[model samples]
Target: MTAWTMSDTGRSAAGGLPAGETAAQLVHRRLRDDIVSMRRRPGDVIFEKEIALEARVSRTPVREALLRLADEKLIEIVPKSGTMVARIPAEILPEIIVARAALEAVTVRAAAESARGSDIAGLRAIIERQRETLATGDIDGFHATDEVMHRAIAEAGRLPGLWSMIVQIKVQLDRYRRLTLPQPHRMERALAEHEAIIDAIAGRDAETAAAAMDRHLDGLRVSLAPIRDLNPDYFSGDVGAVYDRWAGEMA
Candidate 1:
């Protein structure tokens, strides 16, 4: 398990915050990012006091932030055992892939119809940066760019609100994606898929763009088995049962 620590600089990982952002909101954002990025790994315990000390805030805010994370299913707060980052359960991957594929396919189709030349240029610029990150072996940078690329598609499609909803649901999927980042040829394959999607959109072929998005998302499903094999302890074999037990205990 990885240890959690606050930066001495006191800046949020999500960058500059708007005015009047509460301590709980800052803590929640930082912790959520850390958990998704695997800086705080599955099953790692989180102490409110330690987090409070690091964030230079009261335990009240830490507790409030944790409850918010719990609502997102990003972390589990056990009655006696305290809080821990939630494991990336294998059972939910298929569902998440399906949902994301449906939403993103629609998004790309819309983008093919609505995206301006500048939007396409911006996406290509991001891909270029992604290529640079791959060459430099900056896995984190590549992943960050990957997210921006997808969000750019949503923005181009005039679905920024839908993108927010996708962000909420893709937290676990993001973790799974992170797990596959270091795999052999994975980044290259993803880059190729992204290019295909971009090409279809640039050509204003809505059908092709949707097809490409579906194919790209389906690739995520293909990687799940290999990921489970690689990190057996990181997923629940019986996810429903586990969730039921957690809900019962919480109730």
Candidate 2:
């Protein structure tokens, strides 16, 4: 058995669960992160034997981890064929974008209205880091910074639930964004959008901040439109099939 100990985050040491639970939470987080970050992109086949051998755990725990991932929509558990990373629908893109736009707009507006000097300082610090990443042409770092910046805004807004929703949608949006990351001037344009958002918030102009966020989201959709049109296969078709399966329950 793997030695159990508390992780840095104070999670249940190695396994992060009861000694008799038979599954390691750390292993689950690792596997979940891999799929959510698109390291395991949509439609990639996942073999239980392979995962079990790699995690050094039994297939039972690996299966447990996979079930958790499927529940999060990061991976799909196909009947008999095995679990694969989910290929979400293109429609989910716009839906997520819309949700992000609304929530982020509200977040920024709230941040502007209620932010303390320290909150503003923290946001500025994050933006400066984002600027440095862009200057260094660190594409992955920029993505990381971008994720942090938005989360900061949501946090400053004091709406943790809304922030959680953003986290969920971001997993899907990020895959599309990565496809457009190589486009010429994309980073510069993204920087400009971030600057506009920050400036409006700093100026304490809620309307301007909300409008700026909407524009940013609209631009994201525009940039991805061509790529989305070109690559229809990037998302999973299983989403619809799953929907059909659950439609009766939903109805």
Q: Which candidate leads the pack in lDDT?
A: 1
* Candidate 1: worst-modelled 10 consecutive residues by lDDT: 1-10
lDDT per residue (tens digit) for residues 1-251 in model 2: 12222442234535445444445564577676666555676778888888766655678878788887777777878796777878756556666777788788888999889877788888899889989998898877898898888888888778767888888777677777876766789888888988898888888898998988888877766665466555667765544443344333334
Q: Write the per-residue lDDT of candidate 1 for residues 4-47, one digit (tens) a residue.
A: 34453255776444357788887897898898998888888898
Per-candidate alpha-carbon RMSD to the true structure: 6.1, 6.7
- The segments of candidate 2 whose C-alpha lies over 4 angstroms from its true place after superposition are 1-24, 236-251
TM-score to true structure, per model = 0.87, 0.79
Give the Å error, residue 111, model 1.
0.9
lDDT of each model, Cα atoms only? 0.83, 0.74
Q: Clashing residue pairs in candidate 2, if any?
A: 5-13, 5-14, 6-13, 87-235, 87-236, 88-236
